[model samples]
Target: MSFRVLRCLFQSTVSLTLLTLAIAPNSSMAQSLPYLEDPPPPPSRTSQRVRRSNPELDEYTLGPGDLVQIEIFEAPEYSGEAQVLANGMMDLPIGGRVYVEGLTIPQATDIIAAEYVRIFRYPLVSVRLSGPRPLQVTIDGEVTQPGAYVMEIPLKAQSGLQRGLQYPTVPELIELAGGVTLSADLRRVEVRRNSGNGKEPSFYIDLLSYIQSGRRGQDITLRDGDALFIPTAERIEEERVRQLAATNFAVAEDSPRSVVVVGAVNQPGNYVLIGGPSRSELRPGGLPTLTFALEQAGGIVTNADVRQVEIRRITQTGGEQIIIANLWEFLQTGDFENDPILQNGDTIVVPRTDAIDSAEVAQLANASFSASIVVYVVGEVNKAPSIRTLEVPTNTTLNQAILQAGGFTDDANRDEVDFIRLNPDGTVRQETIELDFARGIDEFENPLLRPNDIIVISRSGLARVTDTLETIFSPAPEINSFMRILETLGIVGD
Candidate 1:
């Protein structure tokens, strides 16, 4: 046999072995290999349906502050207006302060008519409710204002689905308390009611559903002494808000939303946040930026430490989210992205230079917001002695401040100028630098002057000795007389 015949035979044998394995039965393969199936679907994320309970309206009972009018058929003298006192009793001509509270209008009328029978024979009497008392309801949690509200009788007959007599609803109560804040979770509104059996029952209202569907039974009429609680939306997504808005419920934006700017800024106060379309109404200003806020605040003062500007915001759970913005880096890079977008109820605090720290600098950047930022120049300049307290805009170089102060004196030692600064910890820092005015500010060691910076140019050695000699002699008459005597005798030169 040739080599080709041998190779062909080996190939045929290998092919036959592969065919046998491919045609193997499933039972045989199952013994060697484990079975596999696709993974089960993920669990549903849908929340449970909220339980709702509507308050009974037809069986409304009388309480304190409700006014009633009683009329007599034959006699006009018996008809008068009466008010239920705080003790739940009413005074009439026939009945001396009878308890009428907790009784419906018809029940109270029967009691009054029976009392009138004692004074007259077969007196026909009628009772009518004159006015409803203000509903005192307590609202708590997640609302902009949480407290007791004395709401007037808002019940009136309306057309359509609300055809029955309507009273103050949950939405009306929330509106009375300044409406719900941004952190409110409209999905879970809880109303706590006394079951009259000494047990307090809780009813959960899904305001999101009511807002979306405009359902008939969702908005519950609040009862006197009923406690309404709105939960916080701590982990709610923005998409949920949009979905609610897509429904019939209109989401109203907070009006007069103010942001406070405090600390080292020139003016520290609350500035109204001009958001939405109102921002565009400004004169050529597209929006309200940090720059606009600082401008409204009269810009940062000389001692402001822009490196650690803090923007504090309130979270959904009434907690604070502090974001430290470094305006210095933002100014350097000229990046608008570095500046934070101010929100309602935000507070911006610009600390002093000495107070800036690593923790503060790590916040968001919002620099390039200041103008009229002043730096000081003192010591051996021409006007520095008389007008030592001088100020120039921020980023004014060392040489420029010195030149603005009428330049250095003839005896000023330019080589050993002392620069004093304040550290974040309130410690005084001193630096010695050599400067040559002929080289100009750009080409030489002319660092930018910061707020509250102090520059001191020392006097020459000869000038210092001359000043010391003059000071010693001017204060002492005896020393002066001796110097004069020595000068007259030619022993000492004038």
Candidate 2:
């Protein structure tokens, strides 16, 4: 055979072998290959159900402090901009007070339309929530803005950045609120939502995923009145293992010693043995006192019951021991006999009290501390302040700091002004300063004052005593002694 023909014959033989293998399946091949039905292509992502807005089923409700716009078709006289009153009613021009409490915009519109029909011919009413709707969401735990944020819109991960240049994330919110303060449990973030029907469902989002993986999807959307709780990390339980490995706390390898302090304590959690004096020196055997624990837990909560305290302890042999201690008795009298010392593996539970007037106390405290050493008046200001605080530095001239504090209080005397500096170390220094208001060179040529320095304006010598009193009482007191007096008298409560 020729070389080309031989090559063609070989190719043909190879092709035939492949054809035979492709056509014929061997028993071993069939047995070796396990059958796998392709997983039914994953359930379709497209939902079939039509999206409907069910206001009644939605947990959020319309409330006061929300701005709304009302329009009455064919009855322009009744249409106007109105805010929801505290009573949940909006006064209309012709419709009187329309009860709109707990109604959505559409629902409110329908109700208003129905009411108008009784008085008018086929009255068509439309209501639109015009302002940032009031939402009762708590940006708590470790949020930058840890408070009640109005959930005007459905909160999404994208909504965070839209608010401002420095938009805060779930983690950022925690950071904004003083970075969880001191004892924030960042590992677990709890988001709780109230069902419209009164049931509350809590969802736990693990912070570790976001912190470790840099995943933004982990940041969950919050609903109105949703509560986000970042508990304190379980330090006692885990720290014990580290302590045992290091042998730092003198915790015996087998000795069962642990204590759990919950409720109203600054650090309400499990605590392990630390090789040192008890937190309270007053307690016998240097055992941690209720007061000390409470202080560590951030002081007693206003609702804490000082009378009812329970301690639960687990013994070495797996036995549980419970004791009831009166915290008030222990606090009032150094009554160690009645209130036993906390042992290792013991849990202390503080009950909530009914007589706790936390809100009233907070209001009074806020009123008392209303003095701002630094004041600023922007816009129509001649000079601006560089510093505002109670403690003005020695280098801070009154003239310069006042310029930074937003300049003289309208009728401020340029020459007759002095500033007082209260040192943290208990020294009061006074400075006689002159401001060259005429000259536009108001910039502080010398060292500017630090923050929290106090700036005071001295009246001109010709000014009367009554004028001075008027100036003194002009600004609202940050801490109103009158309010405090009323609080002490129990005449007013927050």
Candidate 3:
């Protein structure tokens, strides 16, 4: 027989057998059947689901300024829209005013259904969230901009649960505040959450751990009335500032920073520097360091003591934090750690070396931190360019400057010359140094030239005497005397 014909015959036989069994329920065949027994109960929601890490999105907690929708199967009058009041109470059609604040929508629905049970025997009620209020939070300390921020959140729920809603996290708030400074301490970032209660609870999160590992363990979502505080780093060395600077939470590398470079540096003053690390060839990453800042302010002077470069930084407590940077070590060993990175308002003081070594001077002039300086040489210079100014290396000595200016004129003083320097304290220091053009460059006799230094080559004794006699012997004096008499006699009539 065909499969369809076999299935039909089987169904007819089963129907007849069930009818026979129904007619004789106490028979032996019916007693052996256990198919009518009840099945076991399903599991509860509490046992099935685990609490999500993000509390704001895990469940929609009712609060002030939120809209809730209720539905009762046949009782339209008792089921409509309601709003949570500022006092956490919601006015319903049946339960005058019910406190639903801090409770989930399902919890509020159960409470409302129980209240309506006294009036209506059967009330198949349902609840949903229609609207959510904007969140207002504050982030302070170690951030580029510390202030209040308002985040608007629009929500709609058809199943009375949060779906595909992305809540803001700790790092997102920090980014809104212009990102954290390189000196920020991410280990102890604190958050103060204000639940409807009068008490505010506090919690700490270590962003350093999160940044190191991609695990979002405790980077929790922020709620309304939440306050975040990122404290200043006690020591940048401990925090590994270079690593932090490379993160997205840190300030941008190209952003301009105002820094002051004084002491033994060319054009020592305030300058707006903007750049990234370009010196670290040994290690991988780098940052704008003391050497970089010096290059921004013209460059270091010839005799700068790179071994003890002082960086005076302003701490969070308004006190000066002095850090010593050694660029000489960096030049020798290529250790970028010897050249500490620069921060906004940092003052780099390249102190003057007590004694000058000509060999070191040559190396300093060739160093990347040192720049070519301009010096003015006036008074009987043979070269046209050096007569006004000469742009030479930082280690150029007095003899070198004179030779670069074409070895001075015939009447130039070979005995002594005046070296005028403008001091950093707005003072002009002029000193006459006895010169011997034939002598080699030295620290005392033929010292190195500084930027904007004025070398004054005086006239020789014979040249000065000849110039004085020229004035007395010239015919121009006689012509001036005759012209004056002629003007008195009106011979040259007006």
**Best by lDDT, which number?**
3
Ranking by lDDT: 3, 1, 2
Off by over 4 Å in 3: 1-60, 73-81, 93-96, 152-165, 194-201, 214-219, 275-289, 315-320, 367-369, 410-441, 458-474, 477-494
What tens-digit string does per-residue lDDT give for candidate 2 at 1-494?
79999999999998986576566433234212333553222112210111234332232356677666666544466678877788988776665677776776656665565555444433445565555354566755432235765444422322322221111345433433433322234456788877667889987876554544645532455545677776644322323223222221122222323457786443467655332333322222243434444444434443456677776655332345556676556545756544454445567887765563433323322221111123222222244432333332223333444565565544455564454545436887666555554433222322233323445564444454555455455555768856654654568895
- Relative to the true structure, how large is the alpha-carbon lDDT of every model? 0.63, 0.48, 0.73
Candidate 2: misplaced stretches above 4 Å?
1-60, 137-173, 181-184, 196-198, 217-219, 235-494
> What's each prediction's TM-score?
0.51, 0.31, 0.71
TM-score (C-alpha, index-matched) for candidate 2: 0.31
List RMSD in Å for every model shown.
31.3, 31.6, 11.3
lDDT string for model 1 (61-128, tens) is 77889887777654566678888999999987545567988886656766777666444433456665
Per-candidate clashes, comma-separated: 4, 39, 0
lDDT string, candidate 3, 1-494, tens digits: 99999999999999999798768644546433434444322223101122224344437677898787776655587778889999999888666778988987667777666555444433456666666766789998778888999876655343424443445778778777888876678899999988667899999998888777865433478888899988877665723776677677777776667888888887789976665555343211245667777876778888788899988877543446677777878888987677777778888888997777788888888886799999988888887653668899998988888878888788988888898888667999788989886776675678888788899988999998787666545566665866655554567754
Which of the two candidates, 2 or 3, achieves a greater lDDT against the reference?
A: 3
Is candidate 1 or 2 superior in TM-score? 1
Indicate whether candidate 2 or candidate 3 has the larger TM-score. 3
- Model 1 residue 298 CA deviation (Å) reads 8.4
